[model samples]
Target: MKYIPLRESKKEELEAWLNKSNEILAEMKLETNPKKRRAIIHRNKSHWRNDDLLNYLKKLSDGKCWYTEARFVAEYPQLEHFRPKSCARDEDWKKCHDGYWWLAFDIENYRVSKPMPNVKKGTYFPLREPAMAVCDPDVAITRESPLFLDPVNQGDAELISFNALGQPEPCPEPAVDLCEWDKRRIEFSIKRYGLDNTELCDRRKELWVAIESMISEYATNAKRATHNDCKISKGKAEQLIIQLKKYLEPSQEFTSLISACFLSNKVGKALYPKLLTQLLAA
Candidate 1:
C-alpha cells in the first residue's frame, strides 16, 4: 500500500464522529440497566451511520480494503469495528466494548474493508506489535498481540512485497518467519478478501509485463541511438529521465529494475549525470 495523506475535511468529519461516540459511551456508563444499555447500543449504531464519512475513507484509500487491498466500493464496503464488540464480556460490553471508547471516532482505527476480510473467516492476520507501538501506543494493551499490519505506520510496508503475479510476499528479512504467522496472514488475507484471485492477478500480471516491455523498448532505443549519432539533445534526454523517474515512484518492481540497471551501468555514461541531476531535483 502507498502512503495516503489525510485531508482537512476528513479530519473534521472524524472529530464529529468521535463526539457522537463519546456521548454513547457516557450514556452506556451511566445506565446499569441491561435493556437500557442495549437500546443505547442500537442508538449509537444509528448515529454511526455516516455514508459521507465512509465514502471519503474509501476514496482516500483508493477503493482498496485496508487489510487485503481488495477493491471495496458502494455495494462492497464493510464497516469494521477496530475492536470487536465480542471481545468484551456482557457487563463490560454494556459499559463499552473496548477500553478506548474514546477512540470510537478515531479515523486511525477506522478502515474501509470488505466483509470477508473483516469477518476473519478466511484468516486472522494480526498487526505487528512494534509497528502498532509506533502508530498507537495503546494498541498493544488492547490487541495483546501483533499479527496485522497497520496502515497508519509508513514503515510497515517494508515488511511486505508484491510479486509480478500481484501476490503478496514477505520481504527478504531474516527475522520474520515467512512460513508461520506472516505467510498465514498473507494467505488468509488473500483468500478471505479475494485479493489477486482469478482476473485481478491476471490483469495485474499483464500490466507488469506491459511496463517491462516499455522499459525494454526504451533501453533498445537508447542503445541504437548511442551507436548512430552518439549524441541526443539535452532536453530530450531530460524528458526521458523525468518520465522514467515518475514511472519508478509508484511501482516497486520498476524501482528495483531501475536500481539494477543503474548498478550494472547499463544506461549510457553520458546520460548518467543528467539522470542523476534530475533525480536530485526530484
Candidate 2:
C-alpha cells in the first residue's frame, strides 16, 4: 500500500458521467425505501467503471492494486469503491448501514484493486466505533474513523511492516512506534485485505531471499571498495546499487514489502546510508 495522489481524469467526460450519476443519485435519494435505493445503485453502477477513469487510475499505481500492491496477471483489475456504494457491512459481516451512495460516481472514492482482495473485502468497512457511522450523505465523512488502512493516506502505508517470513505485521514500537489505534487498524486491515494468504506470503518470502542475497553481495563489494586500490570492487558496488533501486521502483509489485524487508535486517541497515548516497549519485 502506498499513497496514491488522486487526480481528475478526462474532465469533460467525467463531468458528463457525474451529471448522469447525480441524476440517478437524486432519484435514489427521493426513494424512501432502502431496497429501491440499493436497486438504483446496482442498476447505475456500470457507468462508474469507466474505461478512461480506470486507465488514469491504472497509471497512478502502474496497474497494481492500491491496497495490496499486487498486479492482476491472469484476471482483469477491479475498480473498488474505497467506501462500498450500495451497502456497508461491519467486520462481523453484519449489515451496518447504507453505503456512500453519493460518492458512487466520484473518482476520489475509487481504488484499483485485484479480484481476490476485492471479493474478500466485499462491503465490509470496519470503523473505530459503529456509533460514529454516518448514513446521511450530507455528513462530513471525516467524522468517521475507519479501521481499514487506506492506501490513499501515506501514513497508513507506513503502519504495515513485512518480516523475513513475508508476513505483514503492524509495525512494533521499536520499528516505528505505532500508537494503539494505528496498531489495531493495521491488524484489522491485514486480515480484511487478505494480505497474509499463503500464496502472497510465499512469493514475498522468495523476493526477500533474492533481495537479501543481493544486499549481502553489495555489502561485500562495499567492504572491498574501502581499499583505495580496488576500482573493480567500487564499480561492482555501484552497479549493485542500481540493481537494488529497481526493487523500490513504484512500478514494481509489492514495493512496500520489498522496502520493509530491505530495512528490517542488520546488513541492509549497515549499508543503508551508503546505498542512499550512491543511488542518488547514480
Candidate 3:
C-alpha cells in the first residue's frame, strides 16, 4: 500500500460526529457502570457513519480500501477504527476491553478498509507492550503503538516489498536486517491484510510480468531501431504505451506492486530514454 496522507482539514466537516463522540467519552470519566458506558460508546461513536466523513474518505482514497488497497465493490466501504473501539486483541485474540474509548470519536483514528480485512482486524489492536491507559488521549495513543503497520505512515508502507511472483514480503533486502520486533510487526501486517491472498498474488504477478516483459521489449526494439535494424511494430509500440499509462498512472489498481516494479533500477534502466522521459514528465 502507498502512503495515505490524512486530511485533518476534512475532519471539520465531521464536527457534529466528533462532538457527539467526545460527549460520550467525557461522561465515561465519572460513570462507573460498564453497561452504560458501552451503550454510550456504541450510540455516540456511531456518528462515524456519517456521509460527511465516509464520502470524504472515499474521495481521498480514490475509492480504494485504505488497508487492502482493494476497489470497494460492496454497497459502501467499511468505516474502520485503526484501534478497536470496544476492545483490543493480540494474535491470540486476547481481548483488552479497554479499547481506545477516548479516541473512538476522533476522526484521526478512522480508516476506510474493506469488509474482509476490516472484520479480520476487528478490535485487534495488538501492541508490543501492555500499555496502561492514561488520562490524556494524545499521550495514551502514543503509548499504545500498534504492531500492525499503518498504511498512512510512509515508513510503514515502505516495510512491504514484493517478489516477481507478486507475493508480499515484510521487507526489501535493506529491511531484512531490521530488529526482530520491527520485522515481526511487518509480518503481522502482511498476514492481517492477506497480502499473500492468491487472487492478490495473481494480480501482482500479472503486473510484474507485464511490466517487465514490456520494458524488455521496448529496450530491445528501441536499440534495434537506433541500429538501423528491424524494430517493434508501430501497433505493438502503441499497445506498450497504453500499458505504461495503465500501470504507471496515479491511483491505478494494485499500484503499490506496479510502483515496486517501476522503482527497480534494472527496470528503469531498460526503459528507452524517450519512454522514460514521457513517464517522468507526466
Candidate 4:
C-alpha cells in the first residue's frame, strides 16, 4: 500500500451527487428512529455510485486497490467507504453503532478496492477508543482514532512491511519504535485486508525471486567493471540499475514491497551506496 493523494479538483464533477447526498443527510438528521435512518440510507444508496467519482478515485491508486495494492483483473473494482455507511462494526465484529451516514456521499471517504477485501471489510471500522467514536454527523470524526491503517496516509502505509517470504508484517524497524497499540493496528490490517491471501503471497514471492536474481547479476557485473575495467560489464550493470528503478515507480503494483526489498537486501545495499544514489532518492 502507498499514500493515495486526494484530488479535490475532481469534486467539480460531483455537484449533482453532492446535492443528493445533502438531501439524504437532512432526512437522516430528522429521523429519530435508527431503523428509519437506515431505511433512508438504503433508499439513497445509489447516490454515491457516481461514475465520474469512481474514475477519479481509481486514478488516485493508479487503478489498484488502495489497501492491498492489487490491480483488478478478473474481479470488478469497487468504490468502498473508508468508514462504513450504514452500520459500524467493532474489532470483534460486533455491531457497535450507526455508521457515518453524513460521510456516505463524501468523496474524501471513498477508497478504490478489490471485491474480496471490500466484501471482507463490510461494516467493520474498528477504533482505538470506542468511547470516542462519533455517532452524530455534527461531531468531528477526527476525534475518533481508527485502528485500520489507511492507505491514503503515508505513515500508515509505512507501518506495514513485506517479508522476503511475501507475507505482510509490521515494520521491524520503523523510523520510531511502534507502541503496542500501533503494532496491533498493523497486524489487524494485514489479516483484515486479506494482504496474505494465497494468490497475492505467491505473486509477491515470484517478484522477490526475480529481484534477487537481478541484484545478484548486477553485483557480479559491478565487481568485474571495478577490478578489470570491463566496459561491457559496466554497461550491463547500468542497464540492470535502470530495470530495478522501474520497480520503484508509484504506478507499479506492490511498489511499497518492492522498495522495501531493494532497500533491505545485502546485494542491493552494496549497489545503492554507489550506483543507486539517485534511485534511492526517488
Candidate 5:
C-alpha cells in the first residue's frame, strides 16, 4: 500500500466538521436531563451522517480500504469505529449509552473502512497489554490488541514483504517478535478479508506472467540476432532492453524482478544501463 497524503482543503473540511461535531457533543455533556442529552445526540448524528466525509476519506486513500487495501466503493464503504464503544467493563446503562454516542461523533475515532477485513467474523484478536503499550497513548485504545502496521508510519513496511506468489511473508529483519506479529497480522488480514480466496491474487499473478513473457520475448529476439551474426550489435541489444524495460516500467510487480535480475546476471548487468535510462524516461 502507498502512503496517502491528505490534501490541504480536505484537511480543512475535516477539521470544520470535527469542530461542529465537538460543539454538539459538549452541549450533550452540559444537559443534565437524560431526555435532552438523547435529543442532542440524535440531532448531532444527522449532521455527522453527511456522505461528504466518507467521500473525502476515500479520495485521500485512493479508494483503498484503510487496513486491507481492498477497493472501497459507495455502496459498501463501512464506517468503522476506531475506538469501539462496546467496552466489556462498562456497567452503567446511561454511561454506556453516552460513551457510544460520544465516540460515534468523534472524527479522530472514525475511519472509512471496507466490510471484509474489518467486519470478518472471528478475526477480532484482542490486543495484548505489551502490544498495546507500543501504541501511541492517544490512539492505543482504538487498536484492538495484537498490533498491526500503523498507516501513518513508513517503518511499518519493513516488517512485511509480498512474495512473488502474492502471499505476505516476514522480511529478514532480525526482530523475531515483531516479524511474528507481522506474519500473524498478514495471515489474519488475508483470512479476515478473504483476500487469499478471492481472484485478486490470480489477477496479479497473470499480470506478472505477462511481464515475464515480454521480457523473455525481448531476450530471445536479442539472442537470435547474436547467433545469426556471431556478435551482438550494441544498438540492437540496447533497443531490445529498452523495449523490455518499457514493459517493466508501468508495473510494480515486474520492476522488482528486473532490478534483481540486473544485479545478479551478467547479461542483465550488461544491458541494464540502457534499460534504466528508458525506465526513467517512461
Candidate 6:
C-alpha cells in the first residue's frame, strides 16, 4: 500500500473524540479489577466506534481498505482495531487472550480494513513468541513487537515486494541479511491479511499485463519507422506518461504495487524517466 497521509475530517473534530478517549484510558488505568476495567471500557466503546471516525479513516484511503486495498463500498469496511480492542486471538478465533481494552476507545488504535481479511486476521498479532513473554492485555503495547503491518507506517511500504503475477514476496532490500523479525512479519501479515487474495491478485496482474502490453505496442510502432531507436515519438511518450500517472492516483487500487512494478522494469524506467520521477515523487 502507498503511504496514505491521514487527513482528519473537516466535518468532525477528532481531537474532541481523542479527549474522550484519554478520559476512558485514564479510568481503565486506575481500576485495579480487570473485569471492572474491561466492563467500563467496553461499555464506552461506542464513543470510539463513531461514524465520524470511520468516515475520516475511509477518507484517508479514499474508500479503500487501508490493508487489502479492497473497495469499501462493495466489501464492507470495518473499524479494525490494530491491537484487537476486545482480545487477541490465534489464526482461528478458538484461542483468545484479554484484548487491548484500554485502547478500545483510542482513535490511534483504529483502522479501516475490509471484512474478509479482518475476519481472517482476527486478533492474531503474532510476535517472536519464545523471546517475547506473553503480556497482560493492558500492558501488551509496551512489551509487544507487533507483527501486523500498519498502512499508516511509511516504512511498511518497503516491507512487501510485488510481482507481475500479483503475488507478494518479502522485500529484497534486506535479503543479504534478512531480519528474522521482518521476514516473519511480512510472511505472517500477507497470509493473515490476505493481501494476495485470489481476486486482488487477479486485478493486480491485470494492471501489470495492461501496462506491459502497452509498452510492447509502443515498441512495435517504433519498429515500423526508419532510423528507429526502439523509442516512441515525443507525442507517444507524453501519452504513455499520462497513462502511467493514472495508476499513481490515490483512487487507483494497489498503487504501491503498480508503482513498484513500473520502477522494477528497465523498459518502464527508460521509457518514462520523467514520468518515473513524477510517480516516485508523488
For lDDT, the strongest prediction is: 4
Separate clash counts for every candidate: 5, 0, 0, 0, 3, 2
- On TM-score, the leading prediction is 4
Model 1 C-alpha lDDT per residue in residues 1-282, reported as the tens digit of each score: 333444233466567766776677677668766566666665666555487777777776667666555455456587665544323322112322222343344455566667755665322324444333222323445544434444544444445555666555555553555657656554544454455456655655664565555455567666656666545633354456556556444223223223333332344333445656766777
Q: Is candidate 1 or candidate 5 better by TM-score?
A: 1
Estimate the TM-score for candidate 4: 0.90
The local lDDT score (0 to 100) that residue 126 gets in candidate 2 is 75
RMSD of each: 7.3, 2.8, 3.3, 2.6, 7.0, 3.8
Residue 225 in candidate 3, Cα distance off native in Å = 2.2
lDDT of each: 0.51, 0.80, 0.72, 0.82, 0.52, 0.71
> Tens digit of lDDT per residue, candidate 2, span 1-282?
677777434456556766787788788779888787777878877876777777778888888888878886777778989899878898789999778877777777888888877888889997888899888878888899998888877777778878888899876434457778887888788888899889999988899999999988888888888966588988998898888877766688888778787777787766666666655676
Model 5 alpha-carbon miss at residue 278, Å:
9.1
What TM-score fits each model? 0.62, 0.87, 0.84, 0.90, 0.58, 0.82
- Which 10-residue span in candidate 3 carries the lowest summed lDDT? 267-276
Give the C-alpha lDDT of model 6: 0.71
Clashing pairs in 4: none
Query: Pairing residues by index, what is the TM-score of model 2?
Result: 0.87
Residue 14 local lDDT, model 1: 64
- Tens-place lDDT per residue, model 4, 1-282, is 788877334466667777877777788789889788778877877766767767777877888889889787777678888899788899889999778877776777888889878888888988988999998778898898888998877789889988887888888779999999998888888888899898998888888888888998989999999999999999999899888777766678887678668778887766544544666676
Query: How high a TM-score does candidate 5 get?
Result: 0.58
- Model 6 stretches astray by more than 4 angstroms: 4-12, 90-97, 129-143, 174-176, 219-234, 271-273, 279-282
Native-structure RMSD, model 5 = 7.0
Off by over 4 Å in 5: 5-10, 27-49, 72-75, 87-103, 121-125, 130-146, 172-179, 215-282
How many pairs of residues in model 6 come into backbone collision? 2
Local distance difference test, candidate 1: 0.51
Rank order by TM-score, top first? Answer: 4, 2, 3, 6, 1, 5
